[model samples]
Target: MAYCRCLTPAANQMLVLVSRQSPPYCSIRTMFVSTRRPHKALLKTLHASRRRPSVIRWQSQSAPKKRLLNITPQSLLVAALITGMVAAVYIWLEWKKFVHQAGGRIAALSDSGIGTLNWTLTDQNGKRREYAEFRGQWLILYFGFTHCPDICPEELEKLVEVVEGIDGNPSTPDIQPIFITLDPGRDTVEYMHKYCKDFSPKLIGFTGTTEEIDTVAKSFKTYYSLGEKDEDGDYIVDHTILMYLINPDGKIVDVYDKSAKADGIIRGSIKHISEHEKLRRKTFLPF
Candidate 1:
C-alpha cells in the first residue's frame, strides 16, 4: 500500500516543495483546477429561441385568413329564391305600365264628336219637340235615312242592342235613342213612324224640313251625301257610321265607332258617365 500526505505553509515562512518516490508498484496521482468562462453555444441557442417566436408572430399576421363560414347548399338555394322573386316583381310592374299606356292610347284614338247643340224638330208622330227635352238624360243621336240599304240597317241593329243593354241595366242612367232622318223628303213622317215601330220600342224617330235637317246635321258635324241612283231610280245616302254619346246637358261627350259592341258601349258609357257625374257633383254647387 502507498500513502500520501498534505502540508501547509506557516506565516512569514518561505514556501517549500517536496516529492516522494515509491517502489515500482501500481500508483496514481491526481490534480484539480477551476476557471470561469462563457458558454457560446448556450447563448446562441437562447437567441435562436427568442427570434423563433417573433418570426412565427409575423407570419400569422401577414397570412390571409377566411372570415366567413363555409357556404352550403341551403345558402345557395336561398340566394336563388331571392333572385327569382326580384325578377318576378320587376316583370309584373313593367307589364302593368304597358297595359295602362295601351288603354290610354286606345281611348285617345276613338271617336269624339262635336260639342253641345240646341235645335227644334218634328217627331215621328208629327209632334214638335225641342232638343232641350232630352236634357238630364244620356242621348244616342244617329243621323241616317231609311233609304240606306246596308249601313243604316246595320247601325240601326247595333243601336237597338245598345238600347236594350242600357234598359236592361238598373244601375245605368236613363238614355234616349234617337234616329234623325237624313232623307227627310223620302223618309216621310209616316214612314219613320212605321220604321221606328219595327225596331226597339224605346227608339224615337225625328223628321223635319230639309233646311231643319241640314242645320241639325251641320251642328253635329255629320257627313252625309247622296249616292248614285240605284237600278230602280232610287238614290242611297252615304253617311258616317258614328254613334254619338251625349251627356245629360245635351253635350256630345264622346263618340264610338261602329265596331263597338253593345256590351262595350254599355260598359264604357256607364263608366264614363258615372265618373263624370261623381266629379261634377263634387265640384258643382247648386245656385
Candidate 2:
C-alpha cells in the first residue's frame, strides 16, 4: 500500500496506490509526503520490479573419476610372490600324498643266495636258456607241478591274478611270472606250454633235468616230495606253495606264503615296486 500526499496552497489532495502481490513489493507499506511531483524514472522502476516474477537458477558440475586398478611395479611383484607361494604349497602336499600311498620301506635281503645262482632250464618255447637271461627284470617265482590236481592249479590261478594286477598299473614295472615244475620228466615243453596257457599268457613254465631242478629248488629253499603212485601212474607231488617277489637286480625282495590273497599280493607288489623306483632314483646321478 502506497499513499502520496500533495500539499499545495489551494489544491491540497491525498492519492492512494495499490500494487500487485510480489516478494519485496508486497512486503513494503509506505507513505510519501511532498509538495513536488514524483520522478517518472522512479515510478517506472518500481512498476517494472512488481510486474516480473523471481527466477532461481541451478548449475551442475562434473567431478573427476577415480581409478579401479592402480597397477605399479611393486604391486605386480607382490602378486607374483603370492602365486609362487601357493604353487609351492600345492606341490609339497602332492609329494606327501605320494609318499604315504607308496607304503613302507622295503626290507633288504639278508643273504644273496637265490640272487647268485643261475640254472639252465627248458622254457615252454622249447628254448634252453639260463636263468641269468632274466636279469634286469622283475620276477615272481613259484614252484609247482602240472599233475597236482587241486593245490597247484589253484596257486597258479592266483599267481596269474597277481601278475595281471601288477601289469594293470602303468606306473609299475613288468613282472615275469615263472612256474618251475617239480616233475620235469612229465612236464615237457609242449605240455608246459599248454598248461601255462590255461593260467595266463604271461606265465612261463620251465622244465629241466632232475639235477637242474634240484639245484634251483635248493637255492630257492623250496621243498617237494613225490606221493605214492596210483593205478593210472598218476601221483601228486607235494611241494612248497610260495611266491617269491624278485627285483630287477635278481635279489628276492619279498615272499608271499599260502595264506596271502590276490589283493594283498597286489598291494605288496606295488609298494615294493614304488620303493624300488625311489631307491633307484636316489642312487642314480647325472653329471
Candidate 3:
C-alpha cells in the first residue's frame, strides 16, 4: 500500500511527501517541484491578453486620423492668386531695372533737341506727310534703303515680327512701323512701297530730299555712309542697324540694337507701354 504523507507549497517550490508499505518495512520519501517560474509565466500571459484588446480598442475608438489636403475650388483659386502675385512682383522688379537703364539715355536724347525733331517727307502712298502727323501714336522707326543686300531685310523682318507679336495680343497696345530710306536717290516712293510690302503690310515707308533726309538723320542721331559703287553701279549704304521705339508723346522710349530678338523687343515694348500708361494715369489723377 502507498499513502501520501504530506503535500505543501513553499516560497518557490512545492513539497510532496509519500509513504510506502512493504512486507516487512515502511519507507517515506520527499519530492520538490518549482512553482515560481510557471506562476510568473502564467501571470505574464494573462496581463498581455488583457492589454491587447485595450490597445486595439483605444486606437479604433479614441485616436483620430490625420486629414489629407483636399483640392477644392477655393483652394485652387487661392493657389492661383499666390502664383499671380509672385509673377507680378517679379515683373515689377524687372520693369524697374529696365527703366533705370533706359531713363538716362532718354533724358540725354531729349536734351539734345531730339524731342523737337520732326520731318516733312513723302509717304509710300505718294502723299506729303510730316513726322508730327504720327504724334499720339506709338512708332517704331527704322532707317534703311530698299536695295539693302541682306541686313536691312533681316532687320525689317524682325521688326515686323515684333510688331505682329505686340498687335496679336489684345491686351497690348498696337505699334506703327515706319521705314525711312537712307538712300532717297534710289528708294523712291514706288520702290519704297514695294519694299515695305515685301516685308509687312503694316510697314509705312518714307522718302524725302537730300536736305530733309540729312536733317532728320542728324536729329535722330543716326549715321550713314555710302560704300564705293560696284561694277554694276550697285552701292551699299552702311547705317546704324537699330529700331527706335517712340512713345505716343513722340519721345523716344527705348532703342533695340541689332542683337535684340523679336521676342525681347516685344517684351520691352510692352513694358514701355505699360509704364507710359501708368504715367498718363498719374498725370490725370496727380495722386
* Candidate achieving the largest TM-score: 3
lDDT of 1 by residue, 42-154 (tens): 34544564554322112235668766876899999999999999988886776566445533433443334353457899999999999998888888978899877787888
The reply for model 1, stretches above 4 Å from the true place, is: 1-115, 283-287
> What TM-score would every model get versus the actual structure?
0.59, 0.61, 0.63
Tens digit of lDDT per residue, candidate 3, span 69-186?
Answer: 8889999999999999998888677766755655666677678776367779999999999889989999999998988888998999999999999999887778999999999989
lDDT ranking of the models: 3, 2, 1
Task: Compute the lDDT of residue 216 as modeled in candidate 2.
Answer: 86
Clashing pairs in 1: none
Q: What is the C-alpha lDDT of each candidate?
A: 0.72, 0.79, 0.79
